[model samples]
Target chain A: MFGFVNANPKSLSEEEKAIYQAFYCGLCRELKKRGGQKCEILLNYDSVFLALLLSGLYEPPENSFSFKCAVHPLKNREAYENEFISYAADIDIILSYESLKDRVHDGGALAYKKLLSSLEEIYRSSAGKYEDKAKAAALCVKKTTEAEEEKVSDIDILSSFTGEMLSECFVRKKDEFSEKLFSCGFYLGKYIYLLDAYYDYLSDRKKHRFNPLHLMGFSNMSDMTDFTEPLLTAYISECVNAFEMLPVLTYSGIIRNILYSGVWSRFNIAKKRYLSKEQKK
Target chain B: MDPYKVLGVSRSDSDDDIKRAYRNLSRRYHPDANLNNPNKDAIEEKFKQINIAYDQIMNERKGGAGQSAGRGPGSSYGYRQAGFSDDSAFGGFSDAFRRNNERQQQSDGISPEMQAAVNYIRNGRSSEAMHALLEVPEYERNGTWFYLASVASQGMGNMANAQNFISRAIQLEPNNPTFREFSERLNNIGAGGWYETGRAAYGNPYGNNSSSSWCADLICMNLMCFCCRC
Candidate 1:
């Protein structure tokens, strides 16, 4: 959930965008409700996506209301409250806390460790609610970090760990949908992990750090993408395939837009930048 | 089922339209593309139906201008009539995986672990197959080692890992058509790749040489320099 999942704003209709924003504000409000002002900053589109997906899948009663916030001081924002949003918010805290813990463990500056400890009280409260999910998330982080330290050249093995984490988090219920939900999270997580590596290749090269794509001998951006784009396409296709199996009708228009087009927003922009850089050289 | 109905085309629809529909369906339902799908028996069946429909349509139009011009449907549509049953073209994972290992053992002695891994893969014990493969010393791993690794990973539901391993296999044995074919089938690259499937699924009926995309890319490249001031 490293802030990579997003809906393409340009692709969404005005009404659809507003609907998405309502969920966004609703998630923000939920975060504030849990950990007050400091936790609001952790509000992200990925968590909002989980909330939207679960909401669309299960038509839970929404506690709708108009709320005023500093972001929109003059106008009251249309906000929604539901069990899923609260659930997503709890996951948001647990994941955020774990990622911070990873950075601090990775010999990050003292400030990061301080931040991790600062969020502990909030994290413990949320993590205590879903011990299974939190433990699974932490385990994946540990496995992924260990793989990175070992310089595992097989990126598939490296990314699979992160994918496994999402696979665990996606299954909130045990039912017919669990298998497909598990698959959806796995592929989505792979796409996110690999795309993150794709964007960081240049800096990773500069620092002489490990990058899976670079290790594959694709020194140039075009070569790297030529190697990567098909993999990403296959992954996103599988993710959408699993998503289609879920019986989700309401808010599906917006959710489909995000899954289909929005998720590619960052990849497209990064491609243009990297390709243009190649041209400049 | 009527060939036209299967292809979602009609006699009134031009031969081009029918062929295009056939091309899209074939790629979408290709056995190589859906190696990871658990319900693969159905896909292979659907692929057969698509092929039969396409051949039926093509045979009906055998004397058309395309046939008269010596351009076979095989080349233009990227369909291989032989590929339908050929081990090299659409051998799914197990056959493809086994064929390559047999070829490797022909010239020299294959490590016992490599042979064991192949048997394990054939028997649907990919986890043990992977462990057996790990027993092979790193120095002795040829393209076949990487190739089998990819197949084992495929069986274990580690698709992305499978793709990269096969790609490495191809890098090690670039000219080995079997390795190249395995890489293409695993990663969905080269001819009948994922991008082609994408173009076929989306509205681009003409293929990658469409004037619209060519012009768009040209303009984007030109404008990138002018606008960014890098």
Candidate 2:
């Protein structure tokens, strides 16, 4: 939901990049198919990662064709068509609707209600199809709000809720690999929650919003940068270890790059920014 | 089953090669990773065989080496005999207690509260142990308190807190081999190797003994009800 699930483009090979782009556009196409054109606006990197992970785990057959869309009217872009992409698109709509509802509740935008109402039918259909996933997402949102209201200081507790929610999303069906999927999803979710808190620490502190890393005894962003890098690195290592256990036959290289070096690339950028801000201060 | 064949390793394979092969095969056949396979039962059976094969080979190798070196720490038979005596009471409290006691400075004897927490930990009452530790006065907290707190935190799956507390324990007693070794284990968690061995040796903090998983399931069930309230 935070849109932190991005692959390191530099680390990807040309073919992998092409595959990545095709999938990205493929999600966009599915979003339009399921939720209409307006839903395309809700496309996020997190759902793309979801599609990639599912595709890797399921090893479903893929088909792609070049097509020109509104975004790229002059050039033909390859769009992947697959079951996982469609599933991820539906999930994207559900998450977007939930986030919009949250925004409406926070009193930030009354217009968000109009968008929510427009997406209500699509959201309900998707939610009905994936009842367990929808329930998990709703529960995580509810618990996260409760934690924020209660001002919970423990990073693990706060992240665990998010982790469990993502675990549910990763589980397409209750199969033998469900436990590994849950473990991988849990750690990645925890890493994202912590990363979001770290990234938003400065603004959250200024706005008097709840930030778990800030509350976890970190005096400033610099201290947070130092502490979270190692912790996040450990989580990534766990994720990779679990990932390696899965019998992924195709696109394993791409997934490996994203998990191993891609995540670290994002972390370094954030660290550099934090360090620069500290130097200025 | 031939241990080498079961692990898909050659008879001439080195220990590291055997270990690598086992790790790969186990990951592939692990029940969690093979749920959708039609041969789930077969895979599970094979996984058990692989585990048994690895253990047999390692034990045989250890036995041979132990005989050459005489009776000592390297002797697997001697070690197991020693372990049997320690495992008999409170699920092997003698070993853990003795190790902790050895690290205790001459003037810094184990407190009753510390002893009670250790007992709770041994009995799988991690929450109770955590509660007892929390009740200790701030000034009275020492390396032992922090070390035990790390164990409690690890049991709760709060690795961040576990890492912090264990690091504090190491800082307080820099030369304590047990503390340093535990710290290294915490640091290398999920990377396998020593971490796995340490977890098996010292006992799993997040094992079936903890009720946290049940609590989580209950909370999730209630939350599902709440979400479905139309």
Candidate 3:
């Protein structure tokens, strides 16, 4: 989920945007309350997407509240709340905590060492709720960190770990749609992982770190896209294929925006920046 | 009757031995073999039982569970459980899906293992197709082999392998229309059927060669305007 998935703002209307924000704010409040200020810092649109997706699928009871948040003390905003929203927050909190554990074990993110026990206390209370998701996140985080350190560059295998991780994350409450949900998350997870790699290619190159596209031997961004684009599209297309089959009429429009176009927000930015630089060179 | 018991083989018997038993039982007493016999009704009933037993046993083996006993005649969904149904637009898959077992004749000079792989793929058993393809000796893998591998890979949710395999098929038999058509579909699958709903230039993520022609990026323009990021 790596903080990359986002809804494209230009595509949404004022009302739709507010609706989206209501849920986003709802998730933010849940995160802050459950995982504390440090955990709130880990809030991302990816988790919000998960929440909204599950909500769209299940259409759980809505719990709307009007309140002034820490960010908007002058104006109280109406936030929509639901069990799925809280579930997403717990997921966000647990994944962040697992990430912290990974950093500590890998002896990276050293600054977070002191906060581990505190986050662990929060995680202990929350992990029980979504034991499946926590276990998957913990294992995937550990494996992903290892893949990075060991420089495992088989893109499919590397991406699949994330796929499997988020696949578990997607099936919050298993029903007949669980398989489709898992497939949706699996391919979308692969898409996000590949997109992240492509976006970080130059930066990782400068740092002499692992980026799967590096193995493709692209002399320029265009060449890299030639290899990555089809694979990426294939993945996201499979995601949409599953998404279409899901009975998610609630946020289908917004979810379609994300699946069809919004997910490319980062890619658009990364490609333009790299191409323009290459032209200058 | 228990399919294994009807077939006169225990579950412990190897697949080949069971298959041999079915062949022998069906051959001597098959309806076609007993056209003029006085006991034709009983023979036909016995033949029907033999067919059902074999199908049930195969379904059980394919699904790896005992619950396959009462499934419909075909276990097509067993393979599709991997997600992403094979595009039936490809010409051969429909016929393959309709195929009954006992197709060991290997028409068109295809290896028996490749034939088996095709049947597995037809039934949506991609992992089985993969195994069958792997069983084919390397010397016999033709363009059809690579093409079948692509189909099986796609069924298994391994599109990377599917793309790679179909490309190999094209390279080996460039003029094969089926291969060419499949390659085109495989390359452009996800982007199709999407542009109709999305007004944004979603087809090409990087936009066209013009660098600014990407008009599909803003689909669902009235939905919302504040998708938050980290």
Among these predictions, the greatest DockQ belongs to 3
Against the true structure, candidate 1 reaches a TM-score of 0.66
**TM-score of B chain for each model?**
0.43, 0.45, 0.44
- DockQ for every prediction shown: 0.06, 0.08, 0.09
Please give the lDDT score at residue A168 for candidate 2. 76
Candidate 1 Cα outliers beyond 4 Å, as residue runs: A107-111, A205-210, B1-129, B132-148, B155-161, B164-184, B189-230
lDDT of 1 by residue, B29-90 (tens): 87878999998999999988876676555544532311111111111122233211222223
Best by TM-score: 3
CA-based DockQ, model 2: 0.08
* TM-score on 0 to 1 scale for chain A of candidate 3: 0.93
How close to the true structure is residue A160 of candidate 3, measured as C-alpha lDDT?
Answer: 76
Query: After best superposition, candidate 1 residue A8: deviation in angstroms?
Result: 0.9
* Winner of 1 and 3 under TM-score: 3
Model 1: residue A278 alpha-carbon error in angstroms: 2.9
**Fnat for each predicted structure, in order:** 0.07, 0.07, 0.15
Task: Quote the RMSD, in angstroms, for model 2.
Answer: 12.2
- Tens-place lDDT digits, model 2, residues A1-281: 76666666554678988888788889988987886666766777778888998897776789989997664577788989999999998888877787788777766454567667878999998999898888888888899889988988888778878777777787787654565566567777878888888777777879777787766686777777768876775555545544544456467767765665554444556677788888999
lDDT of 1 at B25: 76
